[model samples]
Target: MSKPSLHQYYLSLIPNLVSELFFYIPKNEIRDDIIEKLDFLNTTNIFNTIYVVDYYKGPIEFKKGRDNTRLLLKDGDLDKNMFNLLEKKSEVPPHEFNYVLDKYFELAECLFYITNWMNTNINKMLPHDDTSSGIFYMQSLSYKKHFEILVKNFYPTKDIIPKGNFNALELIETYFPDIASQYHKPAHHPTEHTTPTPTNSVGVQEEIQPVLKKTKKPPLITALEAEKILLEQVFNVDFKKLK
Candidate 1:
């Protein structure tokens, strides 16, 4: 027997949960095109040209999804077409993308509190320390671009994601002053802000990726110039293993 997919798990869990906020279904019916795109991520075909090797997940044009060179089906589903798209940019339509991305998040091993408390007053909720990296501590992440304009505009700068580590005190006083005002005041980054922009759009961006740039050997990813490239460019990094 195999473990259940993220979808299956959500279905089983949804029935028991009290909060209806955690839902996978779109308010309006899901578009057939989006359904096809979502379904495509579940199917893994070695001959499909999506994977360079015999398995899924890897490093290729981008660096985040897998440790190797090929892109993960799950991650690739959200990308825009290579011609018009870039990595980490999800294509799922804004209206339905939120429902879909939440489905994708099931794959990420993270704490609910991390997303839940990102804005609210950490000092009010918990003890704070000057040296300690607050709960939201993070310099930046790939998904920041997708955040709705409201969260984006909330910050004075265009690029809202910064401060590698989110400190409770810092977030309340400095970082997300508008929404992190919860408890003490009001909070934000509502569920609606998830619409994919260059990034948010979600997994069904209906993207058509070009064939992966395969490695010399399926089992071992090696290149003559790759050593220098990987060392200088990709080493110690989680994404983009190829040169």
Candidate 2:
């Protein structure tokens, strides 16, 4: 038989590896089906970032974009048209645009880094008894470790109760319930905090509650709650506001 290409081998092993990883994941933390869905998405190369709306259900959407995409950079520095297209196509709320974009970008960076590493090291990662498992094992371990760091650092104030060793979804849900409700309609009206109006009633110029500070939080996130903040503040996907 002809020697199988390294890429082909890596691709072939991904499914089984993903399955095994999912099997190791705690059930109550996240539905097996959801993990399967995520696996499918990753293996299929559909979305770079998978938004787990509800483990009991399915992903709300899969995002596509470069991990390095930045919002703060000038439009000329980026694929402005592409970014605009995503903004227009997305059902995300206006307020939550920056948050969502930044989160997805960060996630893309993580995934891209792993995938790129795999691609670069594929030659040396041939099938061997000790190292034959390929780079996925190490990649998965790194992902898990980084994921823990992400969870802790992102939501420092939130209470975190570990559901299980492998139940990342449960840990996420416990820390950020709003993310669980991402697919659900908003339950309340959008909160409006008033600021000084730019123009005075008499005509004098005054400060106005401009919508500049819609999002209020750190950008480095790894948990679903970070996703929620992005969706609500940047995308404006709040059900309450929609109603």
Query: Which candidate number maximizes TM-score?
Result: 2
TM-score of each: 0.20, 0.22
Candidate 1, poorest ten consecutive residues by summed lDDT: 18-27
Model 1, 1-243: lDDT tens per residue?
997553464444322111111101111222344334432222422111211111323222221233432222312321231212222134435434334334333211011222222212223433453322221232012122222222323332323333322222332233233333332433364333333222242221222222223433131112212222222221232223221
Q: Give one digit per residue, the lDDT tens place, for model 2 in 134-186.
A: 32344344333333333432323222322222233443343233333331445
lDDT, candidates in the order shown: 0.27, 0.32
RMSD per candidate (Å) reads: 22.5, 20.1
Deviation of model 1 at 96, angstroms:
13
Q: Name the runs in model 2 displaced over 4 angstroms.
A: 1-98, 101-129, 159-243
lDDT of 1 at 183: 27
The Cα error of candidate 2 at residue 48, in Å, is 21
